[model samples]
Target: MTIDGISSTQGEDGVQEFDVLIIGAGPAGLAAGIYARRAGLSCLILEKGVPGGQVLTSPMIENYPGFPEVPGMKLMDHMAEHARRYVDIREGEEIVRVKGGERFEVSSGAGKYFSRALILTTGSTHRKLGVKGEDGMTGRGVSYCATCDGFFYKTREAIVVGGGNTALTDALYLHSIGCKVSIVHRRDSLRADKHLQESVAERKIPVLFDTVVEEIVGADEVTAVKLRNMKTGVVETKPVNGVFVAVGEVPSNQLA
Candidate 1:
């Protein structure tokens, strides 16, 4: 089981082999385990959690080219410390079961591996607005991460459901951290881009547009948000202590 320090090669029925398993540790499975260990092979990765998947909930990142800004968990912790110097990551595991042709096996609660190539990268998953109290108010104030909960809603008050580009970049990162943001949008223009709708109208924020949240009120945290509007069918409620959501993304692929 010693990954990273190497020694976990077994394969004469002992399983746990690998000339490249990958799965997902994000950043495309840590750049396909550093190009499958610089093309020499061995590789591994795995990772069910903890390895910067959704760019670790991205707070700042000026389009990764040469780190013009950098933050998404410090650029995935420098790409998982440069793919752990050469593969074999293993964080938490979670493969479940795979089994393909000439090699592949996989499984995972804690064992069975083998792999003559199987790279999934498994990314996306953050698109829920199925309304109604949103799964018991998600982490309390309900959030799909505005930089991982936007500093606990800085000055407080938040909304940002969706209008694209990750809900206007999480309403300009919850109005640049002081929170008090808004933006509901069930339509009525704004699919973000045009410099993020001109930086959310030069930072005036507010927005609501055609609205539509319809429930996520709160009892142990979020405190308000019922909205409706969609061309004046009206219905209000909007107090807000945080909600964020960002509406889009759903392809973790269920281990395809």
Candidate 2:
């Protein structure tokens, strides 16, 4: 077969060839693309989702090398744009299977391509609570991102899960925007940095120790959450319009 009446001779195997194939479009993948392109290698980046990855969902980033307190999406955009100048990137293309051999054959739904060197920068996915009403009320009221769903909770009360850096940061952001936010932690102490811990105390944000989110309660939107005391086995219901799950992330190392 041929396109535009021309022969399609991608060898007999029908796989496109490339010197390097980078999977993912996050910071690591983009950086790899830049290096490969600068080395004068035929490189291609296959991104299953958006180009910027999790950076797009970050609210604010303060400690990135040069920039001070820049928006996450803005920072990721710049990184993606900088890589685009030298590398060829294909967004919305997922590398479903990777065949190892003398050369790696990358297969996706769109097509198949072979590369001498394969680099996987598949970042990570947010871990879910798997509680009742969570999967059903994802976008409606329950969310995993503060930067993406914080604005919608203006002047409303919100509940933040976990006690890590992400959870603390999200709580502070929510409080800043007129939302009365509370932290529910399964541990007595937070796993965040000391500075953040001090800030949380300074901000007077309530943290329920040994507390776990049992269920996300709401109808059309999130109205409250059912929390259980891990130590005493006492269950309490708190009114909240938003719930941000910042528990942790599951690495995308399946291809690796």
Model 2 misplacement above 4 A:
1-14
Each model's lDDT comes to 0.84, 0.87
Across 1-256, the per-residue lDDT of candidate 1 in tens digits comes to 5555545578877777877788879898898788877777677888888887987777777778999988789899989998888876778888888878898888889888887879888888888999788897788898888887788989999888889887888889888878898988888898877888898899989888888899988788888988989898889897888898888888887767
Q: What is the TM-score of each candidate against the true structure?
A: 0.38, 0.90
- Distance from true position, residue 53, model 2, in Å? 1.8
Which candidate gets the maximum TM-score versus the true structure?
Answer: 2
Task: Report clashes for each candidate as comma-separated counts.
Answer: 0, 0
Which tens-of-lDDT digit does each residue in 142-214 have in candidate 2? 9899878899998988888999989998988888887888999999899998887898899999999999999
In model 1, the clashing pairs are none
RMSD in Å for candidate 1, one decimal? Answer: 13.1
- The C-alpha local distance difference test score for the whole of candidate 1 amounts to 0.84
Alpha carbon deviation, residue 83, candidate 1 (Å): 3.5
The local distance difference test score of model 2 is: 0.87
